[model samples]
Target: MSETFDVIVVGSGAAGMTAALRARDLGLQVLVVEKAHKYGGTSATSGGVAWIPNHGLGGSTDTREETLTYLDAVIKEPVNRERLEAYVDTGREMLGWLGGEGINMISMPWPDYFAELPGSRTDRSLVMPPWDGRQLGDKFPLVREQYPRFKLFNRYSMNLEETFTIAARAPGWKKKVATVIGRYWKDRSTRKMTKRDRLYVSGAALIGPLLARLDHKGVKIRLETKLETLITTGDKITGVTVSHLGRIYDIEARHAVVLCAGGFEWNQELRDRFYPVRTSIWWTSTPQGANTGDALIAAEKIGAATEHTAEGWWAPTMILPNRSASNFEEVHQAVFDVGRPYSVCVNRNGDRFVNEACSYDRFGAAMASDQLATGANTPCWLVFDAVFRQKFTAGGILPSAIMSDRSIPMDWWDHYIFKADSVAELARKIDLDPAKLEDVTRRMTEYAAKGEDPEFGRGSTIYDKTFGDPTCQPNPALGAICKAPFYAVQIHLGDLGTKGGLKADHKARVVDGSGNPIPGLYAAGNATGSPFGLNYPGAGGTIGPAMVFGYIAANDIASRATNRDVASAREPVAT
Candidate 1:
């Protein structure tokens, strides 16, 4: 006999959790299945910000018309207008509902990636504040954790504001750092329980609370349960065949199946098929062995349509060896790190390509375009001088003042970062033409002196200046790379995750090529082609729509159920 539920939500990321929560609110029996031992997927490792425009949180002044106009300006590809409208309306409602349920979200003063675009503003992004993980009790261990690099000393986590302050070395940053560390040490009970901090921040903060609420509602969430296939009766989805402890069994979904299994970033075959750029799947920032597109593949086999099939949430990643384990490598997305002054990313032929201070998606797109044009940009080089090394932090490499170049492990020097005394020497070490690199550096020096980039307009936008050094003279993002001990690190064309998958409508129902909804089927998150197409609007662009659509899907199902119930009540007595 199969266990039955009104809604079966696959994957336990923000989207799935949101769907489960909403379904339960509508008086539905919800079952959430996660493939990993942990519940939250990539969301747990993410920044936990949601790009909810006009949410009225944090004094936001955004309007629906303005927000739509902004989307029109940024998204180049065609998308369903209804889906766009739903994203706007449902996003606000979903976020507001979450807030009322005590899943508190605070707006961050983050500028849109395309701040200069029409309808763009600096108030759409929202992030969860820090929460106490101790409230979760034993369930805390089941929550997915952020990457080690996101934590301080691989133990304590910091909020967005604190991270920004310390990274920018803003006023009272030292005191803030001391307070955080001091407070952690003073909590002797938490330390004794686990090395992980009781104070959850970022992705964990969002997921932790959602989990607590779902538990209170008695929603059953099974971990290490892999969805093998979707059970279908004709054109309608009935349930799913899932494997748990090597036993495969069917679970009946009485009403609907919500596929929120994230993107296929970690799946090599899918990446090779859908991604236009030629790069290893290992370059992705998502957790390995997760997000392999189980939902997408199963849906596709049943004739579900796809869109935006050749893009990702692109970012340049620094490849590094694990310090504690040399045999393994770590891929860290270096979006903010690249925007800092005194650095320039160049192709293999030693030519500066795109604006170094542009948004990460644009920067990564530039890499793809450059690679397709010249085949010399996939493994691009981010070159900087000793001044930059001293002033800014690189991936896994602290500022020289904090952890000097000499202090970095020799293995990094051997396998990752390249350092030399001059631009020409650095070029030689990285296998680039010495003269070409010298010329590029010479041009960069001129650009810095002029406080402008005539080639790519590096520091022209508010978004560009967000990650810059305000202390720098003239343009904050422009600085000369003339100091000795120049460095170069190879940057791979990497991504936060793949952005393409099964196409979903405004109601969050999976649609076919004919634009008809696949009855009893739904999808959200990276599992669906983003309604915004290729555009990444703000800090939480990925998660915002994901959660909104998940909420929409649950409500849509409940609406159908409500109508059926009303119809039954109206039926004439047949007995």
Candidate 2:
């Protein structure tokens, strides 16, 4: 027997949930199937910033013309102008709809990754307000928790403001630290009693309330259900064959099948085929076993067109040995840490390739571009000094209050962290030419002292300074790597996820190779060919488009259904 729903949403991330919720609001029976045990996909572990331009949040003054102009400046060829326009125009409407559903949101003051871009605004991003996990009641356990390393002391989840306050050593730092500890203790007590922490922020906060809303509406979400294939009638998708707990079930979609399943970051074969630089699951920050591009493969099997297959939302990542395994590894994205004072990334030839303070996407892109020339840009070394170790956290290693033998491990120093007492010795340890490395180190030291990086212009922009130490003079990002006992960690090609997938039209409908919409198929989020093409416009670039297109898909499906019902009503009676 086959179960039937007005809409079947594949994947349970922000995109899938948004589609399901919108469909349910339109009086449609919606079913969401997730391959993972938990509901939220990568969105659950993300920072939860939605880059909705001209959203009017935080008194943003962004305009549609400005946004289009910015898109023209950043996005590349094979661009879908219609889809991009739709996203910019309808983004505010989607936010309004979500807000009406009692989902609390606040303006995140983070600037656009490309603040210098024409349409960029500092207050364009919006994030979900902190949520109390206890409100989810029995369902709290099923919600996938954020990665342990992302939290403070693996206990308290801090917001952007709190993170900056502590990192910058702002006024009342002691009081803030005490408050965090106190909250962690309270959370510990709650966890002991109920087996779930109460305070949820970032991605958890974004997803928790949406899940709560879904629960309130009695929406059916089947976890551990993997989509095996799409059941199509001619060129139109009608249903899907899915396997749940080793049991295969055929499910029918009465109106539409929405694919929000993630991209192919975990699939090595696809990475080798599409990516400019070959990558692996070991490098991505996405949730384990979640984004294998199953949906993308399924769509391709039905002749769905794809674009931007060579691109990903890139970020330089460092593997943490303590959290790695044979099949999977935990990756810490080197975002703010790399841009802070006392740090610089160098290729195998011991040369700086890019502005270290730029956005992660640009940083990774620079590394990939450099690899095309020398083939040795990846596995690049992130070199830093004793000052960086004493002042900031990097790759999950926290700053030490007192420098001692116990503070720095012998095994770590010998294996993961290459340490040397001098620049020339550090070059020798890392297999770089002593003269070249020393010269680069000397130049960096000179730049740091002058607070100017004429070579790469580190800390030249507002976005760069956002992650830098405010205490640093002239340039917050530049610092002399002259301190003794310099340290280095291997960084690799990492990403949030691949941006390319099944090509989608303006209505979020999956388009065939001939450029026609496949009747009942739709895709959004990372599962669809990104509307941004090659450019990452803002902080929430991935999630923003994912949500807007998901909403668009739902609205289009709902409108089509209404029109069909109207046509059927006008049909002549059989005589």
Candidate 3:
């Protein structure tokens, strides 16, 4: 006999889980299925920040008009205005309701990615408070582990605040590090079970609480369950055909089926077909072998339309050589560090292109454009001097004060940061013309001394200076790169995830090619066409809309759904 659910949510990330939880709260029986062995998907590995404008939290003074103006200014592609409006209004409600459900979030003063825009603000991003992983008991092992870059020494994890504090070596940073290590050591009980710490931060923090809440609400999440196809009755998506432990079964959704199975960033065929440029999956920071467009493919087979297939949440990334597994390689996101003092990203021609201190998405877009135009900027070099290395981290290496130049493993020299005694030698090692490289370096040093960037306006915005060194004389973001022992690390255009997939409406209903919502079908997160289009509004831009729309989808279904059970119209085609 087949099982029945009020709602069947595919994928177990924030969007799927939030949809299930919200549906359950509306008195619906929900079943969450995950393709991977663990829950949380990419959300568990992300920074776990949600950007909610006018949230009225942490004294945010954002307004609806301001947010709308800002989105209009920043988002260039065509978007459903209703979805944008719904996000601003419903996002606040989601935050408050989640808090009431015990998912405590603190407002982060992280400025919008486009700080110069009219509607941009500094107080809208929210992050979950760090929680104890031990609270989840044996289920702790079921959650996906955070990326190594988010942890110190690949062991103890730190929240965003602590990460910034220690990275900048700010006041009391020593005490903070000591306290973190101390806490990890004190958790002898957890230590006995596993080397993983008791403290859960970032995406883990948010996911941990959500899992607990789902368990309390009696939500059943089937791990290692793969959705083979959406079982539809006419135009209505009635349920799903899923395979588990080599057994195939039909689970009927009495009301609706929500697809939140994430983007196709990992699928090479999809990337070659849809992505604009830089089609290498190795350049991405998302989880490997996951988010392979399962839901997108299944829905498209059922007549769902896709948009923004060429866009992604662009970011600059460096592929590290130190850590290598059988199939996986370490990728360090150069989001903030490249914006700090004494560094510039240059093409093979040794010319400074975009402002090194611009928002990462913009930086990535610049790289993509430059590469497409010139064909020499795809694999760029982030050039810096010894002084810069001493003050800030580059690639995946820590600051010299902590990791030191001499103590660095010998094998990492060329692969990680190509070290040379002078700018000319560094240029020669990286296959750039020595004279042009030196000329660019000299001009950049002059800009640093003048406290201005006439070429690219490097140190001009609040967004630029957010990760800069305040103690640097004059412009905190500008500093001389004239010191000897120069270093350059290769950077690639990377992304948090692909931002394109199945198109959906303001109410989270998946729309067909003719722009009509498919009955009993819904979608959200990276799996759907991003409501914000190619523009990233602020920190947590990717995950924020995902959670909000997931919440909206559940509510929309609850409002219109009836308790009529539909029999399967036809046999589901087995894959």
Candidate 4:
């Protein structure tokens, strides 16, 4: 016998949880199945910002017309106006509903990645307030924690505000440090008893409240349940076949099956098939064994169409040798680390292709574009000076410690960090033309002195300055790499996750090749082609649409169910 549910939500990330919770609110029996041992997929490891336009949470003056206009400018080919409009219209309602359901949220003062674009606002992003993990009790163990690279001191997590406060020597530096240490100690004590970290912030905080709400409603979430395939009855998806503990089970969905199983980031075969160039699974920031394109592969078996398969939420990633005694390498997403002054990214010909201070997504796109054109930007070099080393941390390497540790026996400098006494020498070591690099460095030095980058306009925008050092003279992002002992590291084209998957409509229904909805089937998050196409609008661009579309799918299913009930009631009884 098969267990039945009104809706079966796959993947248990932000999108899956949102769909499940909305279905439960509408008095539907929803079952959430996750392939991983724990809930909270990639969303838990993210920055947890939701780019919700016209939300009014940030007290910004924005309108639907303005937001749509911006979308028109950013989104590329195969634009779905209906889905885009639906996202903008429902984003606020979704956030408001979540807030009413006890999820503490606050408007983030984050500028849009493309602040120069129309309708850009510094107030559209929203993030969760810091949460106490003890509130979750035993359930806290089931929640996926934030990535270790995102934490401070390998034990405590800090948000953007706290991170900047410590980095910039802000007014409350001492208090912030003390508070982080105090919380770490408290968490240590709790770990002894609960075996779980106590204080949750950032991505974990965003997901923790949603999990709490699900627990309150008595929703059944099955972990380590991998979806094998969708059970189709004629043209409609009726159920799913899942494997748990080496046992196969059939779970019937009475109304619909929502696929929030994420994108194909970790799938090498799919990456080779869809990506324009040769890309690897190691380039993504998604957790291991997650986002194997299960939803997309299953949907394709039923004639579901797809779009934007060649694109991703691209970002530059620094490739690091394994610090742990493991054989595999480590890749860290280069966010604010590249935006600090005294640093510049250059292609093989030693030329700056794009503004270094731009968003990571844009920077990656530029790398891809350069690769497509010259076939050389994938392994670009990030060059920085002694001034930047003294002031900022780059690619997880601390300059002060590295410079002082001369007694170490390993050839760490040769394998990872490249150092040279002159710009020409550094160019020679990195296999670049010494004359061209020298000329570029001299021009960059002059621009840094004037606080201007005439070639790319590096630090002229609010978004660029957001990640820059405010104490720097002239431009916060533009600094000449002229000091002795220059350093360089190779960066690759990487991403948070791939943006393409099964094609979905505004109602979050999976659509076929002819652009018709596949009845009883739906997709959200990275499981479907992103409505934004290739443009990443803000900090939380990925999650914001995932959540809004998840909500839309639930409401649409409930409405369909209500209509079916009314239609049956109107039928006459046969004698």
Q: Judging by TM-score against the true structure, name the best candidate.
A: 1
Q: After superposition, how far is residue 140 of candidate 1 from its true place, in Å?
A: 1.1
State the lDDT of candidate 2 residue by residue for 1-575, as single tens digits.
35888899999888999998887777777799999998788998898888888676656687888888877888767688899899999998998888888985678778788877776768777888778887888778788888877766666677767767876566776688788667867666576866345777888888899888887777789999999999998768999999999999899998899999989898988889898776777888888767998998998998998888887898888875653342344678776777777888889989889998999899888998999988888889888888888887676566655334366645566566778898788889989988988888789889988988999888888898888887787788888888888888888888999888889999999999999999999999999888889888888888888888989999999998852332321222221
Q: Report every candidate's CA lDDT.
A: 0.86, 0.83, 0.85, 0.83
**Model 3: worst 10 consecutive residues (lDDT sum):** 566-575
Indicate the residue-level lDDT of 436 in model 1.
90
When superposed on Cα atoms, how far off is each prediction in RMSD?
Answer: 4.0, 4.3, 4.3, 4.4
- Which residue pairs in model 4 clash with each other? none
Clashing pairs in 3: none
**TM-scores of all predicted structures:** 0.96, 0.95, 0.96, 0.95
* Model 1, residue 395: C-alpha shift (Å): 1.8
Candidate 1 minimal-lDDT segment of 10 residues? 566-575
What C-alpha lDDT does candidate 4 achieve relative to the native structure? 0.83
lDDT of 2 at 396: 57
TM-score of 3: 0.96
Quote the lDDT for 2 in model 1. 58
What does the lDDT come to for candidate 1? 0.86
Q: Give the TM-score of candidate 1.
A: 0.96
The alpha-carbon lDDT assigned to residue 273 of candidate 3 equals: 94
Candidate with better TM-score, 1 vs 3: 1
Model 4, range 1-575, lDDT digits (tens) per residue? Answer: 35887889998888999998887777777789999998898898888777888786756688898888777777767668889899999988887888778775788888888899887878878788888877878777778887676766556778768877866555787799788777677666686786345777777888888888887777778999999999998889999999999999899998999999999999999999998877778878778769899999998998999988887898777866666643557877776777778888889989889899999999888988899998888888888888887777676565453334353226557566777898888888889998988888788889889999999999999998878877777888888878888888788788889888898999999999999999999999999988888889888899889889999999899988852332322222221
Q: In model 3, how large is the Cα lDDT of residue 116?
A: 87
